[model samples]
Target: MLRQYELLERVRAYDPDADEALINRAYVFSMKAHGSQKRASGDPYYSHPIEVAGILTDLRLDDETIATAILHDTIEDTVATPEEVERLFGPNVARLVDGVTKLSKIEAQSENQRAAENLRKFLLAMSGDIRVLLVKLADRLHNMRTLHFIANAEKRRRIARETMDIYAPLAERIGMYEFMTEMQTLAFRELEPDAYQSISKRLEQLHKGGGDLIDRIGRGIRAHLEASGIEAQVQGREKHPYSIWRKMAERHVSFEQLSDVMAFRAIVGTEEDCYRTLGLIHGRWPMVPGRFKDFISTPKRNGYKSLHTSVIHDEQMRIEIQIRTGDMHAQAEHGLAAHWAYKEGKDEAARTQHPWISDLVEILDHAGSAEELLEHTRMAMYQDRIFAFTPKGELIQLPKGASPVDFAYAVHTDLGDQTVGAKVNGRVMPLRTPLDNGDQVEILVSKAQHPQPTWLNFVVTGKAKAKIRRFVKSKEREETIALGRKLFDEIVQRLPVPLGWEAIAEALRRLHLHDDDALMEAIALKRIDDVQVMEALLPGSAGKGQVKPPPQRQAISIKGLTPGVAFTLAECCHPIPGDRIVGLRREGTGIEVHAIGCDRLADGIDADWVDLAWGNESDGGTARLCIVIKNEPGSLAVITSILGNHGANIVSLDQKARDGSFHTFTLGLEVHDVPHLMRILAALRATEVVSTAERI
Candidate 1:
């Protein structure tokens, strides 16, 4: 733990105007609040907070941020209150500390839910003040560093996975590459111990074999730059084991296949010098094809700027290099924090430049569940970005595989909802076209246009998905309720007595629905049986103790589905009349009807389930048959003759096996109902050509 005087001196070194008294007081308050507390490592708990504070000092953060870091855990882990912290420190520090504090009151769903909710809260907090994120990142970093001290293996893995999935990516979003790299390294070690150990051992062996290789190359580059009359500082190091392993995984290559494992950086005095350095290096070596990225000219979405390239040196060695000015280097290292002012405490404008924080905050509102929030945010954070521009030259950044719908939403949510078509690079293009970097995109919208369920299949950005989903959900409910009303009138007309307002009101009460609309929706969604609704409207109206199965005239009718909405029978269950059925309703796809109790229904939990019954008037449908017949000459003729005699028409034919003396055929038969299909099976079984017969 950093001593009080030492921590103050470190802060003063960065900003002489830092409030020493405030820092001293926060240190004392945190220390006493955490007195006698111990961590899983059996270290004094105060050490954790102070260590986090020490980390902020390295970033040259302001006094208030450092103090917030020191007291961040006090509110959650100790008896110290936010009000008390505000009294001691100012409101800014107190708010920052509170933002970093984990929410203990979240209902326990699982670790994932808790992590997602916690992520949701801090993302909102970071929208107002980024210092909360900075402190939170530091806190996570320190905890990850000490994670091995925890005894429980499952608990350790959960924390490590959360850090890898959420925190590391978050750190990357802010351009805190060092923090992101360190956290990823630690998390990778815990998550994939064997892979981590193998990569580490390989790297160590390379280090032992190659003495001064990194230094020699770095000095050689600096010498070349000096000879070209350019002043520069060059850095060279092997890539971190995690970075190496990730590249291997992504490229599907082995360690022996990997080249350019070492990277060198040339930090120069000016932007011109940075480019000049790049020219000098490329002029001296054979530049690799398609292995160059000029982020300096077009910076990343996170404001990272650098010119990266890979070159083949004369030794048959492939090496990667990055060139940047000193300012660019600092910006690349510290990311958004580089412009965060520490001396004057005036970085609010810098914080405003990060619109992604607000975008994430907006996602918090529309996400359906905690897991969904995490999924969407991960989709937002963890992807290589493609930059597309509007016809008016406004830039829109989206994930690499983003379609025009994603581009429209990234530009504005309203535009996405109204998008009808798009033109990429002055030519008409499909809406599902994946955007390339620097492409000019024109979104064509009309007032009549609204989001379609089909767009969800192609859209990539989280914002587009959330907006499109909201529109779909709202439209689905409204349309479903309308369909319910139509069904309600049809069912009511069948009753012997008219459904008066009094009867309808009593039906809603008996069905535990809020109103007629709720009851209608329930009936339409198949949550309530039509017979049940009749019984509720008038006791015993559905007949005596038990409701009878649907007779031909009493079969339920399905009608009024939206024009584009399709209803199809599920292939898995081969459902027929007299079998209970339900429809799995997924947006952009048909309502797939499945037999009740089919194993496939379990996987459709994410899809909407609607109870369905056959219409009173209908044509015959197909039922599948599995048959085994002797593979003799004229055996096929006997099967066709038997089918013709039984009045069963083969709709489709698929043979499963033709081994030796037997042929196993899977056939779809046109039939009126289950009993009619059973008769065909009996007829086939009675013949010697058909050794065995059964419904599939």
Candidate 2:
């Protein structure tokens, strides 16, 4: 029932050459493709694509994106095919339609998993060509705007959660701040209607009183700049409700404590004018210390650059002001899209501006399966970034709080493998030091060092983790293959007659294995009995019915332990190798073991405590211990030195502080016996200012 002129208007907005003939062809094709179809709202299905196309046109997308938007749903819900689309339109238009079509089909086992996979697919498509995601986002925006039409509550929640996790983040990543705000606001409204209403009402009241004040402040600032012969446009924009909600949660403060909820933007003609405008603004108002940022000189990782400062007006009202050139404004609004010029055919230059896009596209080239490509896409796209730097001033981009090990891997796998230590801001730090913005990190590497299995715990980047996993898996495969080959050769030597491949294969099948390699590896690991392999290869072998005897059980009992209690292994002493241990009955249940004089036990023990002993047959495992001490330089180095000297491999380490000067650190280590653990504890306690050391 929609008029044809509306569709024509959208096409003509981006394409001046658009005419009635083209619009008519699209209309007839879409009408036939979506014959008698109705949406969940019971509206004619053709109306949805028209609405989606309208949204894209409003965003100033190119002609192909708009056309693709018009036909996006045809292939999924109708009889239309990609081949037919290509025949009707050109390859570019068809590709865009195909991308949008692919995004509509992922099915996961649960709502959360479905949302996650849907996001994964969206990122994959976006990485290939950003316009695909743009069109999809526009579609989602329209759907969210009309979400009330859907009837089911569970379905509504599932869709809302997906929008929150995927679409909203996608909008932010692309620098569509306006779209991001709306999507988040709508999703919040659906997911937590009560919270949304409460926050919305509060924000509405705040805006009513403060709106005119911001306008007055903007006028005053504009008058001053104009009097000084500066040419600029000043406008006041309030923070979105979702952003205010996020700020409240992050700062744990009430809405009244939130300042700078409104900001003034100054748009100028040149980059030099931006800085000059900043100087003029500061002269008019007092600038707040540590509240100024010179992003123009050093842009954000996403390529956002502006001069920002918080200043107090004559009435002592605080406001944030941002100064940037007109070009920067366009970049801020359109993000990577603003850089692409179709007329110039500068694809390479455009890709250079958005390196992450290129990196994501490159993932497709190396990806072997659809699932891997999808995974790589999600990891590359849906991440919040932190900008850190090498000591030499080279920038290294990583996910927020990425450790030095992640940094080393970002530089090169070889560097990560050889990295022995690191320094942040000229002071040595632990390998797990969470990086902050603008940090100058210097990695110390030794030729003999290699990555430990524990490095996986602190790494934040998916690329770094994937690479580490790949390297470790490769090494493990190589080792297992070599072990398998060695065991096979030894077993063949013991055979009286040469075994045929068929006999070996049959023997492997009887053992539930795939090949000789697996059977031999199982033998190497003692998972398969050695005598059984010979029995399978020979007739009437004695090993056929002979089950191996269980190993002798070490007879041991703890005196202070109660029966029928559940116990957990202590991480501090990681009871591995060989060691003497004593059990302490905890108040609740299971026994806690410690190297007899563990400081943790000593502090808790009074006259009522009794001694407990461990059974003789205990094997090596892991244990945890806590150390409290003064925070100082090289503190971690001293601890690791002691543990390393005692031949104990440190498995995990975490540290926190009650105050800046004092820290409590938890360290997990493997030890041979109770005596060795006590010796390490004594060495750690000998360090100055060490208050306590005990098994936890």
Error of 2 at 273 (Å): 1.3
Off by over 4 Å in 1: 102-109, 112-118, 344-696
Error of 2 at 70 (Å): 0.7
What C-alpha lDDT do the candidate models reach, one value each?
Answer: 0.77, 0.68
Query: For all the candidates, what are their Cα RMSDs to the real structure?
Result: 22.5, 25.2
Evaluate model 1: give its TM-score: 0.55
By TM-score, who's the top model here? 1
**Cα lDDT for residue 535, candidate 1:** 89
User: What C-alpha lDDT, on a 0 to 100 scale, does residue 645 get in candidate 2?
Assistant: 89
Give the TM-scores of the predictions, in the order they appear. Answer: 0.55, 0.54
Residue 663 miss distance in model 1 (angstroms): 58
